[model samples]
Target: MNQAVRSEPGPVRQTRFSFGNPPRGSVAVVDTIEGIECCSEAIEDLAENAVHPNPFYEPWCFLPLLGASDRKRRLRLLLVHGTNDDGSGAHDTLIGFFPFEQKLLHPLCPVHCLCPWRDSYRWTLRRTPLLRSGAVANALATLGRWLVAERHAPKILVLDDLPGGSGIIDGVERWRAEDRRLCHVPDMHESHLYRRQTDAEAYFSRVLSGKRRRHLKRLRRLLEDLGPVRVADVDESEDIDRLLNEFIALESSQWKGKIGTSMASMPNGSEIAKAILKEAHRRKRLSLLTLRVGDRLVAARSAFLAHPGCFGFKMAYDEDPVYARCGPGFLLDQEGIVRLHDDGDLLGKDIEWLDSCAVEAAALPLSMRTEPLPLHRYVVAVRGGVSEIVSRRFHRVMQALPWRIRRMSAF
Candidate 1:
């Protein structure tokens, strides 16, 4: 077990939070980007052994976001460390890593809360923290106790967009069960997931209806009639900047660009994305696929690779009226599925599934080709107070409202 240390220049203030004497573990808070960089080695070790993999939380993807100049919120990291069994006092093993932000639950509401950190660009899709396998329960307990002991801790802890069946949920449940004072309200919704159970042909045949498959075939034929259609994987040796520029340009030509929501439109967005992709490529965790008609690129998909799982991060398709009928995006998805199952060198044979990383409405089109994975959001009272009562009542009111209204009023 490597000793977690902060070796960055200047005074490094480490604050410890605990209930009574430290039991088997302890929690340390690091609020600065430099402090986080100093613990990169330990964090990377925790990522490798985490109970579940979250590519967005990995240093390669997260560090660059922290350094982005346009970032609005201050992010703080909670580091949970496990102590050795020996009598010697040494908190040597890194057990958990949770990055969060403190803010008001809503502008209309006065209740301050702690939530999983999100960047101004909204790139992170998963909020699950990296907890060392086999130590999830202890890590959760340590974190909970720390929250309780901290003098200025928020009344509520809201974790949103956590994938269903995540260990974080189970650990939180166990901790809540032990501490009955904590009140929790959890809500779930479905997302898209693709598991590679068999060869692509067989898998698609099993999931896609005959009529739908025929329609896709017809669409492919239409594309072929226009020109030669091919699905190609971006060569790993190609320059990352050039590939990213192409992707950004393609995305900016679509509706996102018209609405001023494209990556190229956001402040410092292109630079942050380039840094993230460059780091991911350097770490061998990037996979890019494209669909081209003759000489023109129509659709492209980018995914991040974590061992045993891949996350579909960003995708863009030519929105030209000419190519709309060909369903270039769907064609690209079909090809991507084939490559995931057949092109071992591209995605690696070890990867078992691909998470679309999209919301239910956005993922509806892929429902036939993929399975529905539930995602959850939980609002829990870390320490009972006026804020807790207001939050619980607000949640109850939202639940009683219609789905659309609830969504509109969501915190």
Candidate 2:
């Protein structure tokens, strides 16, 4: 495992409240981002065993995001506590964790857009032990209260990129059902990337035309003949530095570098990626695949491993498009996918799903697993007024508009 990364000391604001039916436990509001900033192992433990596992929730990804955000944005963490029946509140266990950005609320403006700093809206709750019945729903109630009462965000909270039948979704629905006049609409969109069955070789063979498969095979052979070709998966702390350098250099050679968006082109982007990779490495949630000829890296991919799934974080290939014509990136993907299906990782975690975290109309052939991923923009008003009427009308109009226009308004 990589050496643990630490966050700089900062003032953390906190408040506690007892919650849940039959007194399951307390829910704490963490106004500052300090709670999970340095707790990689704790968050990893939750990711592995949470009621609904989201690989992106790993500390490696979110903490770096928290650090990278401009201080102008308000980041808060909601923590659910579980403990013994005694009301003393001693030895409380952390039963749930979710982070949120407090939106800028203008009193007269009902037409404001609801958007997160980054794509983080998952309410990750641990499975029941103390609260044996409906733990997920219970946790969401606490979180909902925190969002409205503490953070003072619009009652119409916009949650993004949630899978159907997720516990968080259930919890939100449950709250809406019980709470007075609480309404939510689930907006669905197709994320072109989803999970497929295990056999990589079989899937690849079935997807490609015979002639195209042959061409890829021939190109693979040609690339191999260049020198001693090898594919390596690095998870230990040792090889992360190599992965970072090779990936940045490879990606920089592409259009993203010229546009000043690639990691190599932006120093802040590079550091956040580095911190996330290193911390994820420590918790054994990172996988980096390198395709090399002799000692030269030809292609590389960085991914996060967790919760019976793998997420495609980033990818890069050789600078020369002559190599691109032959699809060196595809070659790396083929090798890496096969290896993952064979073993998953050193621990043999069943990597059931490969979440592309990508949009519709993508090129990669990720066989559909569940329903099309729906990116929802939920809005609920605190009370009926010009605010509620204007907010609903604006959101309805926005949703009815063309996809491009609606997307532009979201920013």
RMSD to the true structure for each prediction, in A, is: 3.5, 6.6
Clashing pairs in 2: 156-380, 189-374
In candidate 1, what residue range of length 10 has the lowest lDDT sum?
Answer: 83-92
TM agreement with the true structure for every prediction: 0.90, 0.78
Task: Report, for every candidate in turn, its global Cα lDDT versus the true structure.
Answer: 0.76, 0.58
**Residue pairs whose backbone atoms clash in candidate 1:** none
TM-score of candidate 2 versus the correct structure, residues matched by position: 0.78
Across residues 340-411, which tens digit of lDDT does each residue of candidate 1 receive?
787456775688888888877884336444678787877777546686686668777766767876654424
Please state the error at residue 241 of candidate 2 in Å: 1.9
Give me the runs in candidate 1 sitting further than 4 Å from their true place. Answer: 1-7, 10-12, 19-22, 69-72, 83-90, 363-365, 398-411
Candidate number achieving the greatest lDDT relative to the actual structure = 1
Candidate 2 accuracy as lDDT:
0.58
